[model samples]
Target: MGNCIQKTNRVVLGFDHSSGNVSQKFSRGQKKDNNYEKGNLAEWQKQKGFGNVKKTMNPPQTPSVSGCLENSHPKSHPLPTPNPISNTCHRGHKKQPSFLPLPKPEAPPSKHEESSSIGTLQPAEPSLSLYSSSFSCILPMPMSESEILSSPYLKAFSLDELRKATANFCENSLLGEGGFGCVYKGWLDVETLTAARPGSGMPVAIKKLIHSGFQGHNEWLSEVNYLGRLRHQNLVKLFGYCLDGEDRILVYEFMPGGSLEKHLFKRNSPSLSWARRIKVAVGAARGLCFLHESKSPVIYRDFKTSNILLDTEFNAKLSDFGLAKAGPTTEAQTHVTTRVMGTEGYCDPRYLTTGKLSVKCDVYSFGVVLLELLTGRRAIDETKCEEEKNLVNWVRLHVLDNGKVFRIMDTKLEGQYCKKSAYVAANIALRCVNHEQKYRPPMTYILEILENLPSNKNLNIY
Candidate 1:
């Protein structure tokens, strides 16, 4: 029994250090490698509250929306089986074809031209006229692979330049590892965006892809397509990319505060005050709202605590666009039908069962994060008793009950927040997580509720 439990831990909860992003799920037939070392496992168990488990196991094969699934949890607390959808096969879909060949890189624009053009570009308006013109040429509608590759907004870096920036991808510089590959800490000149000494210039996070990993060129292209054009304070800034030889690398601004998942779940981290939690919640909602309200709406297929990054000031920004999809283009079309892909517990029940996705899917995910903020609990935790294993299921009743809501609030908060405000936030989460897709509030509406919560900045901290 002990060996069985140890194997289960490896298969289900393989921990990725630095960033808490869950590792990719392994298929039943694939060989299991010891990707995570024993020392790292010990540290993970200490920090995350897992006890007496040391090995990883590959569990029975289950139907996944995408051929690959992200961030799976323990088998004892398996995700609810999705109901079948008409026209959808029970077996996971095959890998889609690779994107078209990228056009040659255009000459870098003059500093003045680059600065001036960026200022004129605005978020796509409801009319979409802005997106349909010059902006639309580079947008991800039908995904013009050539236009996205040549856009002046992104810089094309040579492999040698990145080697200097990342100290040859040194082991000490590693920030985290995920399904795609490992992320490393690097530095670059603020103005020229060229490689710089370790402690001298601007810091950046470089994601270098593993050629053999589950994610591949398509996912890398998806990030460049969306983030390459869209710009907002709430979204992480993509500085550039490297496509030399078989290597695929992405450069993004370094987020000094790490991920929200660490702050909320890591044992020794400082507790986020009530006001700070509200601020983070509002910031994250704004990012999602921006994506949904765009001229060409975007569905953030993967939304979870680990993907919500923070800066030194505690401002939250959304990251990881690998699974994001473009929404329906015409009003007549209600939802986009695509492969299901997302973290296990946070995925919308409707989406998982039907493979039909819309902006409401993102709303459901936001609600799960909101609950995490209010309760300081993970979406899934095997350490707890069966009844309490799933955070959403366990808290649904308590959050709705006026008398029980307070009991569920994070004890770390120490009753510093206003009961009235807390109750209002709880109700908003309940509405967003409603099983019926239509009942879920849109990201815009959810943003309004979070922003308007009274005394958001000045909540008594004592």
Candidate 2:
């Protein structure tokens, strides 16, 4: 009986081990076998502070061993399957895809699985530029031909040419000396480069001034300032100037006939014909009118025949602007006052007495010159007898008593003067010499009467 009981217990233990509930299942077989396993589990649970309980594994099913083995790669990643139906066709297919999507990629290895994979990847390095790090690869700028040529200021003449033309400023080439400096006659090459400074077609008179710095510079500038800027038939023309270094020279057209004084009073030359004399007087009057009544009035402080220059054509130009004074503008209330310095006989007595010079002073001097032209006599002559010594006093005596006045006419003229025009001109002279400044007519009035003088050259007295 004892053997049979032991055998039954073994059978019960086997069944429990084979099949059991998760809550009450035992690894050993039968109820007795279950009690033995539970007793061992209870002892371990009591030590761990928990009741005994059975646990079961619930895992997702994987592919069959054969399918997984065929698809498995030596790299531990499954090989991608190629489907002919899904692959894009070769060229010349009727069913061309409008848009194609990228093929799905294989999954990356699990972190634990990839730990022993290929060599470790280095951190990505920063990108470097082929050109400069700070600057961009922009193109260089281009320049125009005109821009390059026009960049520099041009010179009128080359330094070498100027040096040669001035004869290296030789002392003998000197024309006239003045407060500014000496004037030199120079031969300038007409085909020079100063904004069309070509050959002057003839030698020019170059007035050069020594350096005195910029002190009183504007006044120095004013000396040739108007001459350089003015343009008229009777006015002198300034070609150019040199303001470089210690040289301040003004270039002008050379007038060949010399001045009116050279021809008028010089003993070696015969007196000008009445026709030429009248032409010169009219031309000079027109020049004075231009100065006195232009946009800017100019008073030629010295208006005697000496200052009247004659060109080759015998065209008269009023030169010697050194003593000229500009007229008053609207903003200024008074005309300029300057120290008295003028030829004695030609100076206006009213201005000499009052030291108040005006445009009328020039008109008074013009009248005196007219008298000189009429009588062919000097304003103040020392060769005559004491009674006739002073031309003004003698003229005053004769003009008051006209009977013997014709005797005082220049012997060279041989009575070649219009009697009626001479009387009118003498009356004009008498009016110009009036003691009262207001009694004298303006130069413009004298100019108007002289313009109307009979042009018939044959009406003469002998």
Best by lDDT: 1
Worst 10 residues of 1 by lDDT: 1-10
Q: Candidate 1 — which residues are off by over 4 angstroms?
A: 1-142, 401-403, 456-462
lDDT of 2 by residue, 275-358 (tens): 667677766776666566554566777777766777876877776555566666553644455545456567676665445667
TM-score of the candidate numbered 1?
0.70
Question: Number of clashing pairs, model 2?
Answer: 10
Provide the TM-score for each candidate, comma-separated: 0.70, 0.56
Clashing pairs in 2: 12-29, 12-30, 13-29, 13-30, 14-29, 16-29, 17-28, 190-198, 190-199, 191-199
For candidate 1, write residues 1-462 as lDDT tens digits: 010001212322333322434334321122222323334555444343345554674322323222222122221112232222211211333222111111111234355543232222343443443212123222435347777766455788888999999899999889998667899999999878999999889999999999986458888888877777776667787888999888999999899999999999999999998889988998898788768766678888888888899999999888988778889878998898765566767877776555678998999889999999999988878799876777776675443222367877899988888665686677678667767676566775566556656563555433
lDDT of 2 at 388: 66
Candidate 1 clashing pairs, residues 3+ apart or interchain = 7-57, 10-56, 11-56, 11-57
lDDT, model 2, position 30: 13
